[model samples]
Target chain A: MSSVPLPSSRPALGLIGLGAFGRLIAGPLARHFPVLAHDPTASDDSGIEGVRLTSLAEAATCPIVVLATPVAALPEVVAAIRPYLRPGVLVLDVGSVKVVPADVMRRGLPAHAAIVATHPLFGPQSAQDGLRGCRIAVCEVRGDRSRRVAAFLRSALSLDVILTTPEAHDRDAAASQGLTHLIARAMLAMEPLPTRMTTRSFDLLMQAVEMVRHDAPEVYDAIARANPYAEEVRRRFVAQATRLTTDPVQERDRAA
Target chain B: MSSVPLPSSRPALGLIGLGAFGRLIAGPLARHFPVLAHDPTASDDSGIEGVRLTSLAEAATCPIVVLATPVAALPEVVAAIRPYLRPGVLVLDVGSVKVVPADVMRRGLPAHAAIVATHPLFGPQSAQDGLRGCRIAVCEVRGDRSRRVAAFLRSALSLDVILTTPEAHDRDAAASQGLTHLIARAMLAMEPLPTRMTTRSFDLLMQAVEMVRHDAPEVYDAIARANPYAEEVRRRFVAQATRLTTDPVQERDRAA
Candidate 1:
């Protein structure tokens, strides 16, 4: 693992979203990078120290541009900033689902600018304290830039970088995260529970709730309703339940 | 909270089952009671120190009797011990579900012996070190004897006693424990995950597995197939899942 060298002169960093997750990363990253930030919802003057809140055109002046926008807003955000990106500038999107963002970047970003699509498999809750020990899946859309960004993440953030294609990332996530949140919602919907119950199982469910509870509704909606592969995983889970119920004997026999 | 008063002279205790749970309680209780144990699987010499393994006829000599057997075996065990029970002997069955055992004891036990059915709501894993702070639900069939046993558990074991009817105890168990174990098994069946791949949700699932993992096959069978109210809870859970899948928009709208 190559260490991300602290450049003698910090590279200019541009952040294009300022939601909870975007704000979380912006504060820490500004300490190392000269950051220019832009968020339509946030006032132009609103940004952390060392971060200059600027216009999309002004923010794109940086060598590294981060699309921290919501999944639904990514294509538009990418389109708005693409023309201003200089040659050799690294353009990256930190989103949950990968394939769509990767495609948007590949088609929309200027040919000169390097585009890398990645999913940091955690949220604001996990990143609220810090990003240590969390896994980040890097979908290499463009060659050397993806490796460079992954290397920077590994060395600077101490993140465990998993290299995989965007399609594979979405498919694996359909089971790992998509199915998990779905099950959690199902558990909460099953029955009304007393606030005081402290069984270990209940505690675990509460932990899952805490992980996804404060996420933007758009995140869940995108994963559940928009991710192409998620429905197949959900169908498989329901089919498993149906098999267990309808032909329990056969299920037991198959297990045996 | 009545403290368990140490008997001045050890009362003879009759134990009618010697499974893992039965053995755990029997060994400790023998130090305080002149224990007379009867289990078809164990010979007369199989009991621990201070416990006299004896025939069903000989076990009748004790004033306090405990039926520590599986739910399926409880009916036959209750019948065999009923004729031999002496008057005033407090007979309690420590089973997971209370309604059936309460009914069995009420219908089968001799009028002279008072039946006090209880569900400890915990197990060897939860209490492997000691029984302190655990919750025990006492379904009082015979008032005087039920108070005595509840008082003993509260005082001696330092347990939290929840006084409830057998019907209510079973109903709660159908949701809390039965549904918990069922969901756990479903989670386990979904993936053959390596221990190294543990997430918070997977760890929570493992905790559930650990709670029910040691249970006898008969225990699961009884909970899944025998508990009269459990099937209804399972059906309701499935219905809830179907509704979530079919009408998520309405559900989310209602939640909002």
Candidate 2:
């Protein structure tokens, strides 16, 4: 039942979740659509004022709904929003890993709705300046709207849109993102690292750590554990590290 | 004998052990002082052309001598050059680790000689463009020439000069440089990493690897082995990595 809106029409966009990433994208997205934002944790004490806040049902009634909640909460969010989603509503998700969230959205969303799963390859730290060069991976889950979405991302937002399936994105990301977070975590545990006599390479490595050190704990959880291929990548990394640390060839240099 | 070469007067400077680092500094340094370079392994077929390469004795007889050899070779080079050094000649070393090499140059050379132990904290890779902002640590070993050397480095090359003892330089560098090379080595073992769909942090981390990946094998040997504090740093890094890899609490996120 999910049908295309008028070609030139811009309908309201319902944004669910009000975390750091939620606020980062809301302002830019408001340019194209009237955004109705909702967050379960936002209250009088929360600093979520200024944006147009709405109830869950009202947000779901919009022409487009984006689930910005954590990946672990995707299933519950999907289930809660199901009863209120209008026919022809397009649902999208912004999460770190794609495969699990894509499946959850596909299984729980109303059959009449169209689903496009996306993983914006940047965060508040990386996109602090702007989103001109940021990349986002878009996968068509339940409908044919992903191409149109990717086109809008390229034209309106100046985003580099990579159209890939859930499996492919997770596989490549397991090695790149999974290893990055793991290394950053290990380094953070060894804080007060030397800043005085550092080489250029060490400076670069520390900058990488700075980018992800303040991220929410769940982000690390998703990259290192929630992703399907993360365990295999971690196993290979730890194995190589063990070999380097224990090898007798390395020992010969110790007596040099 | 190296008397005060007179203010604003530049004399011949000898440079020993012409490796990658030696060749890097020779051109810039030659602009200030007449350079005579010596490398024991250089042959006619080697790419040691276009520079004034001379015998070890001839190079060591200059008013000032610099040792650009690996730290592991510092003691031997110090012994071999001792008989040729002129009275009151100023000697300097550019090595990754300082304490051992500083000790070697101190004990082996004649008491009349002046010694300044320095680490350039950079390489051909980091200084590919220029050395305007690069850092060099200068430690006074035998005489008061380190102050003059530090001032010269500041005025001529625009280098950021850090004056410290060999022990302080090695202690900080053991944590910073030692871990960088170790991480780069571990990542190189897992090559063919994903170039597509990489996050910005991963890109920066890979750039760090590119900076040090092609460095000479002896560089790693010296940093990891010749430095006395490097073993403790490596042990701590490995222990933290092991705990992260095996922690039971992290397994809960796996079920998410």
Candidate 3:
């Protein structure tokens, strides 16, 4: 393995939650900043070079800390890191739903600590090859550190950053990610799909289904129930499907 | 285009519908046999290179006749061409749902006429690039003509021919094609999707939505409602989705 770069004046980047996503970003984050990560469930040996699996306190003390826990766990995680945060330190949480985590960060973190709530629009499946050109949504909750983070993501990781509010993110995600995972789950429940005699559309849906089929239960909860707009979006989608199957003529006429 | 191939000992391939699909297959089918096509809506002169736009009676007289009509129109179409069919002529209907068309062909067409129900899985959108590896499901209804058609599809058009029963086709299709178009329609109804913040899964869904968004109402009707199994598949899918959004933890536990 390449030796660690010469120590720079920039403070270390702390990463919490060494799950799939945390591990995905660890190497790239470690390349730029000395990454100290901690996960209660994870063993001491991460196998990823240059990453130091440290304590929660040590992980929170860095100038830039990324909380990569599930949205359900964000409240307790935020509380745990709140006391260890230094003034003006940037604290970002990578959660699927923005509003809940954004609010959690706003209420739990100190005003002096910069809070940026982000949802990396991809997971391990989508970014299997690399993170270059992947999308990430950044919602500024506390301070003006979004631009700095955006610049860092763009330059260091080559991510396409979308700067928006937590409300806007959740609202749009209701139709995008929320509807996507709902379809995936519903289709999985309706299992034993035809392996042969598949069309391009069915194949595409299968690919999308494969991406989210193994997602965590908490992740499903976050996207399906936690986001306020997701339920309504799913309702609208189901109502439209019902129309297509029930009054197909009227549905077709409207679509036409 | 190169000059039309010499007339062979084999009789002409009669196409009784000159709609988009009729036009799509005309060029490829013409390469193998003299294509005699007729559509009440189409003009006498087809823009296709070698296909002869002929009368319904003349088109039905050929040894191989393909009924490329809507599922709702199959009864009348089968009846209209019944008298003109030559003995042992191959009569096929290219409809989305198989059971209805298979029944129509069985009851309406002559006993001596060979009947096959086919569903070309790819459309103009899915087959935009080419039909070399596209899928076509062939369900034999009467007589032993599926091999004849399968050989033609495999050798002439380079299609992937899936041999199965009309019942099997409809059963699997209700979940695969029916569910697919339903999702596309529902997503389209939820319009103005965030184009900027899309994941690979969402993007794949969007591509699928794009594929079926412009499908004709008659086609949608056939796939969504006409197939006997489609309504049940759709009902189960919606029930699962409702369960997911309303009680995600319960849904997750059940799935787990």
Candidate 4:
């Protein structure tokens, strides 16, 4: 017999979505754990290997479960999978915003089930090269499984993991991811921008914009609307931009 | 005598206004021509070799004179250097804006003077290491000397040169440079920005902001106010940004 463990022998991981993000992680995750992926709306198998396309309840019965659904569907997904979670099972979420997902999973999952909220900062375009060196924020809502998750992310995936609270992650994400998506959206709206006769800075700015240009509309919405502090940060940026553009001289004076 | 030409024996280039930009170009151009630099408000030597800090009239008498003064001071500078320009003398202005400076120099300078409006699309911060591969826009306002200047820029400095009229240069720059500075300014106002927990895209965006953060006030002013198309571009960006932030969901619908 071969020394490598067969797909049936490896520990099973229930992945509860086969959307863009779910498919993105499935390939990498399947290397460590045989992924039992479940998505009610998925029509295609996505050509993913080492992943068994299965039913939601069967997928949820695995010892480890990952809710990779959109931020808006967290509550319902949590409720749907609650009946299948075994005691001491590890449950995690991959969402754009952490605060709401952490709350929903914490309130919905059984107390014996461990919950860790994560947000991978890089998208498909950026991670097109690979996921190594990418950033992911992990917050432990229940149990001490966060350390194990961080260890796995560090050793197995080579990811930069930040151990923070739901509130801290959301606060920082509101300014970082929220502003990034907002600016990317604004720049995209002003398309056909000058490509020739450009500066290094403008090129860099456009590169950043290009990275997020193809992200799903729901991703932008979740970052800009779902996170509580996102609106405030965006408002502050807009006010600053308005004052700077409307009376540029006054803005320059203030900046000086 | 040594085979190397003595500093005094080399052809001279008159550089007016020894501000940040003036100092930046002094060393590079000093390699090709001995620079006669004059700044009325100067104090320190800046430890630059092969440059003589002389009076305005003496510096203005060089075969090739470069106006490195602020855009606002272009009119007076052109008028002051009018009587000193010799026949067939190639005079150039290194200002951020082109149309007004081109007009001012063309009307003020003697017809014998060859007026070429140039904008080196880089600042001290961006060119800290060196100027290889930097971009410079060359606009021929008066005579045929722009072709020679373009060849020298490409051969000697390894710069990418774009040959265009003053109007086209201003229009493209108004969008590229104007929007860049506007975004940089707004981001700066929201300082103490997150440096840690940043994605590659956010890092790229911040790096672009950092590249132009230390630019002189005149640079921003010239790009934003002097370039005629700046106001409309700024208004468009602001309107898009305002709508995106005020009701992000509605903005998402519109974007869809």
Which residue pairs collide in model 1, if any?
Answer: none
**TM-scores, each model vs. reference:** 0.84, 0.91, 0.95, 0.93
| Sequence-dependent TM-score of model 3 | 0.95
iRMSD, model 2, in Å: 2.2
- Residue A93: error of model 3 in Å? 0.8
TM-score of chain B of each: 0.88, 0.90, 0.95, 0.93
The better-scoring model by DockQ among 2 and 4 is 4
DockQ of each model against the real complex?
0.30, 0.57, 0.73, 0.72
Q: How does residue A166 of candidate 3 score in lDDT?
A: 93
Candidate 3, A41-91: lDDT as tens digits: 888687888788888988898899999899999999989988899987999
A-chain TM-score of every model: 0.89, 0.91, 0.95, 0.93
Cα RMSD for candidates in order: 5.5, 4.6, 3.1, 3.3
Tens digits of lDDT, candidate 1, B172-225: 777676666666565556675334222344345556666776666656665666
Q: Would you list the C-alpha lDDT of every candidate in the order shown?
A: 0.72, 0.85, 0.87, 0.87
lDDT, candidate 1, at A181: 64
- What candidate 4 gets wrong by more than 4 Å, as runs, is A1-10, A41-46, A254-256, B1-10, B43-46, B254-256
lDDT of 2 at A247: 58
What's the TM for model 1?
Answer: 0.84
Better of 1 and 3 by lDDT: 3
Better structure of 1 and 3 per TM-score? 3
| Candidate 2 C-alpha lDDT tens digits along A1-256 | 2223424366888899989889888888877887778887776332333346778888788999999888888999999999999999999999999999999988899899999999999999999999998999999999799999999999999999999999999998998888788788788878889886888999999999999988887777778767899888877877777766665136335655
The DockQ score of candidate 3 comes to 0.73
